[model samples]
Target: MTEADFAFLREYLRKRSGLSLGPEKRYLVESRLTPICRRFGIATLADLVGTLRLSREGPLERAVVEAMTTNETFFFRDRVPFDLFREVLLPKAIAARAPQRRLRIWSAAASTGQEPYSLAMMIHEAGAQLAGWQVEIVGTDLSTEVLEKARLGLYSHFEVQRGLPVQLLVKYFTQIGEQWRLNPAITGMVSFKPLNLLQPFEHLGQFDIVYCRNVLIYFDAPTKTDVLDRIAKVLTPDGAVLLGAAETVIGLTDSLVPDPQHRGLYRQTAVGRPAMTHRLAAGF
Candidate 1:
């Protein structure tokens, strides 16, 4: 890839998805776009960029977004958040929102849908305990292609194993050819959509629990603050927001207060104090 090709990709991705690809990730850009270049019959990355510039809204642009946004994810990528959901968050949410029996959950960076599906399975296991509950699980990603795949709820064996409990796997998934298809009951539980966090959030309603894990690290501090602020706006006043274990809202934004009991959990606080510092205990 030439400097011109790199410049095109950097600007296009930043404009379309708010993802910044630094010079060090040049290999990543080449690796991701080689097939694209081949498919378009372009001899070089620069040629592909020229073709892309001339093209309007069509499959080419969509392919670029998909290739750049594609990420590796699997069932319950992190165990602790699900554990907290079952043991503490769900119980508290269910009790607090009892009369309404309404709960909304969002997996903001939900790649291929495993996190939301895992959540739906947890709720399904609760059964009559939540018989009257109106549970809404919404999973959104920047890539529409990935969102469609997530809605299908089918996973390869390797994809199903990462952080998923053996018992739940046996109960909820059925063998189909080489892949395992999640029970429709589980896939049917979630609603998937294309949502870019870097843009202003619109149309989508608020939620009681927002899971935006492992995503902010890709963004700059200002983008993180903006995304976090937008997330806080749609969250219920007392709702909880969960980020990746290494991610924090303390110094990144002031709209959240860290939950001492829950790692990566933040309670919506009024916007004013953005410099708070925090330290996490190991294995939380």
Candidate 2:
């Protein structure tokens, strides 16, 4: 691709998906888009760019965005976040919503459903503690393709092997041919939808916890700040937002404050501030 074509792609991706690409990512763009070009039966990247320039919105535009957006994730990825969810975040949510007897969790940028499914598994294990609660896990991503797979609740051997404990695997999954199919008991806990974080999320309603892990690393500072601030709006006060281990709120936005004990956990600022005593005591 020439400079003009590459420039168009970079801007197109950034505007549609909030993906920030520097000049160095030219090769990465080429590698990912080449397959897109082939799939569409287009001859070259320039032709693909030409096709996009003419019809800016349609299946083609979505295909490009989904292709470029990274979907790398696994069950209980990084371990510690799930640990915090079980020992800390979930407990706080349970406590805060005790009067309502309802709980909602959002896995923003939830690639292939592992993160949300992991949460569901833990909730299931809680058994009596969560028995009467109306728990809902919403998993959203920019890619419908991945969302479809997540809806199916099926995993390849390699995928299941990544960060999944064998006991939970046996208890919650049934071997289907060579792949593992997650039981609907856990699968039913989550609902998947295609969402662009740049767009408003008020329609998703308030949540007890929001997991936007490993996602902001793709955007520039301005976009990252915008996304974080918007996230603050959808959270219930005292609601927590969990970012990727490498991502943080410092220098980006003041909508959230980091947890001293957890690497990726942050509480909503101002009214969303953590009620330390109330939060720690609600582990039931």
Winner by TM-score? 2
How well does each candidate superpose onto the true structure, as a TM-score? 0.90, 0.93
Off by more than 4 A, model 1? 272-284
Instruction: Kindly give the stretch of ten consecutive residues in candidate 2 with the minimal lDDT sum.
Output: 271-280
Q: Please, what are the lDDT tens digits per residue for candidate 2 over residues 1-284?
A: 99999999999999989999999999999999999999989999999999999856888789999999899999999988889988987787777778889998999988899999999999999999887899999999999999999999999999999999999999999999989999999999999998999898867877778999988999999999999887876777777899987899999888788878777888777733343334335532
Writing each residue's lDDT as its tens digit, candidate 1 over 179-218 gives 9889988888899988888777635766889999988877
The count of residue-pair clashes in candidate 2 stands at 1
Off by over 4 Å in 2: 271-284
